[model samples]
Target: MLLSALLGVCLIPAHSKPAGEQLGSPLLQTCFEEAKKIVDDAYKYSREESLRRVRKEVVRPHDALRLLKQPRGGTRSAVRSADYMAQTLRLLQERVHHVHKRSLNVTDLLSEEDLNKLSEITGCASQVTFPSCRTTPNLNTYRTANSVCNNIKNPRLGSSNTPFARWLPAEYDDAISQPKGWDRTRRFNNFLLPTGYDVRQVSNNILSTTDAGVVNDREYTHMVTMFGQWNDHDLTFTPFSPSIRSFSNGINCDESCEKIEPCIPIPIPPGDPRLPTGRNSCIPAFRSAPVCGSGYSAFNFGGEPKKREQINALTAFLD
Candidate 1:
């Protein structure tokens, strides 16, 4: 996530209105506008440098193609030409990954603002209000597209289980054919799952699918870049690296709601379809989806308000 000036200190205004009024105020609108500006600036800074490098790397393939176009010169075969193309593609892939990673870091921060606005926009509650961000599908476009899909259906498909059956592929094709629809689709799926499936389901089905187009390749590469950048940033921020042995007894995660009411440890089934099976699945049992805060319909990661004291103390180095 892009570091923000609003962070580490509360900016609710000392004379902040009641949560109800604040919910309706244009503050969130302004927040999103500001966040978007930040994201655009970040992109502008990174995109030029990145694209230049990419074009340079791609020149290898271009040169190989040019060489192949000429008469084989009777001296040497064009075997090395194909090899050059392959290497160029590989390098271009890396360049895409590197560029996309930097871009997504900007997005992670933008998502934090998006989540905050979700409450104000959608009026959904139970959304956590922390400066955290995660990239996923844009719900506005999803809802609109899904609505259009609902209107069109495949007559031949008896069961709705077929992946294509759920979507108005032909209609979507028509829609995406239009400039507006294509732009929307690109924004909606900037981090889109290939095969036009739901973004959440992509993780579940990536192994099953074989079509690894540039889009899918870029998505995976960008995701790794974002995750890696986050890891590095998180380490820098929370550098107090205590070994597990420091908590040999157990983690004293404070005595608040859990200590007072006790955390309800609901047992989940081991073989639930929700979980990953087999030996290599190092999956967690549960995860939460984003929701709106109090007013907006925008998605929030988790609804917990940031603990100012904790964040400030952790970020004291800024002083």
Candidate 2:
């Protein structure tokens, strides 16, 4: 069933417009052209900075905290490499997002080819696209650290830094990249989703433990919870965006309560036990880093608009 679903997704037509068709508004074309230059410059700078850091770390071993902290194994190295790539992709996404927002109306009119061109300009096409897996002598003997090339036929399946396989199609507020619940006015099934703070309050009311109601389990200890967490870490890890600042605006996520891209602050309700009851007192949070080229509607094989899907930093399969 899963294979069939995956194949179905893979087989969806690109739905590209005719080659002679007009791209879009002049403003949209201009935005994309400017974006291309910005993306190219950003990649060049990132590459140069990376090389400089490598050289510095190699020459001054004492300053190599990042290298020293890394575990001495192929798995750790592979995971670190994935982390670097994810970070780079996140930055690229931020840059493109900024450009898109500058002319949102025009951007919304962009076709699949326009988005594909943007992806290529940003170097995300190379990052998200899977490479051909080469079988090794030890292929069956050991599992990879990042779980890449695990399936000889499908190298990226179940791999770290890949998009989660969705059983159902994603539903976004914009029917494209914006997250569900992003717009408070947005409705699902004739009902509105409650705010995060309201849900927290309900949890506090029902799940909070009192001294009088403290119950002990005979069969299990705290180690069960600890082990569960450890096991869970091995299976999936969705990392938050590394930046604390919003991509759309320069506002620091910690200081702003706005539902800007990357910052999704939890508003505190009135008469809360701990937190203050104001917009400014909300808990700060960041959106998870997205899989490169996955969120945009234009990039997917399936012509349906794709919502932002978080990257699974660990293997989907048990490691």
Candidate 3:
């Protein structure tokens, strides 16, 4: 009886089909083709717009330092690669949303194999694959600036411009790609989460320091604070989205207060002490750059796109 039961489990009809064979179904094939076209058009527009911004530049002394601090060489390439993957994944999600009748997480509907096929279609499979790490004599003596090849067995481990490892699984609002607190109406644990602006107001009211409230600490100097910030930067630096405009609607993030992809503007609450409170008056913010092959689904196939994760521009380890 036991042997038969084990055999029954192995012979299950659902499990019999070859992996990713479902993508060949007419519905999925149509969705994939439509999604591909959308991705191609949007990606081209974004790339052209970004280039236009870069070419028309006015670099002052203050801007010089900021520009110098921007990602360079491999790091810059990693960011661009991530942007492509993110754009592809988000558009795919939108396609899936429209095709499915009932509300469901895209991850639930799509398998690892399905996502892999989609990535291949979008040319994202090449971007997510790990590069061959070339060993060097200097690697043994000193850490590479980007932290590549730091580990003999795992070359990309703790590397700069790589995704930060998650201690726990990510918890997106949509359980797939949407960021936390993305849906204003969505409730978690029977409680609505506060808006980013509301949280900022609370911080100002409770944590702001006045001249009388300031207290000097003789044990530590300003160097301590500077060093702390420097050390923090060494460990992690999450770059924001390179595009200043939305890919979906082409709305300038700096001008729009609407919470959209790339733009999560912090609205100033009414009766704020410092900043003005109005519909258009809000602090502009951009979403962090996601790792290629992350923030798409729950399943990961050989470094394929999974849940969204922010890229760390520096080594996570002490260098």
Candidate 1 local lDDT, 1-319, one digit each (tens): 3223433211335244331121222333433333333323433433353345346745544233322332222111111121122222223223333434432212122345544443333322221222111232453344322122222232212211111112222232223112122322454435632421233345555644445643455346677889887765433221111111111122211211111001111222234346433332322111111111211111143533211110100111111
RMSD, model 3, all Cα superposed?
9.7
The CA lDDT at 80 in model 3 is: 59
The residue pairs found clashing in candidate 3 are 293-305, 293-306, 294-307, 295-306, 295-307, 295-308
Q: 1 or 3, which is superior by lDDT?
A: 3
Each model's lDDT comes to 0.27, 0.55, 0.61
RMSD of 1: 25.1
lDDT tens string, model 2, 86-193?
333343344344444442332244566755554554445665677766644477888776677878788888877677777887777778667777888888889988
lDDT of 3 by residue, 4-107 (tens): 11221111233333433332223334444444444445445645754555556653342333334556666666665555545544544564544554454455
- Candidate number achieving the greatest TM-score relative to the actual structure: 3
Candidate 3: regions farther than 4 A off:
1-70, 96-100, 104-127, 133-143, 167-170, 297-307
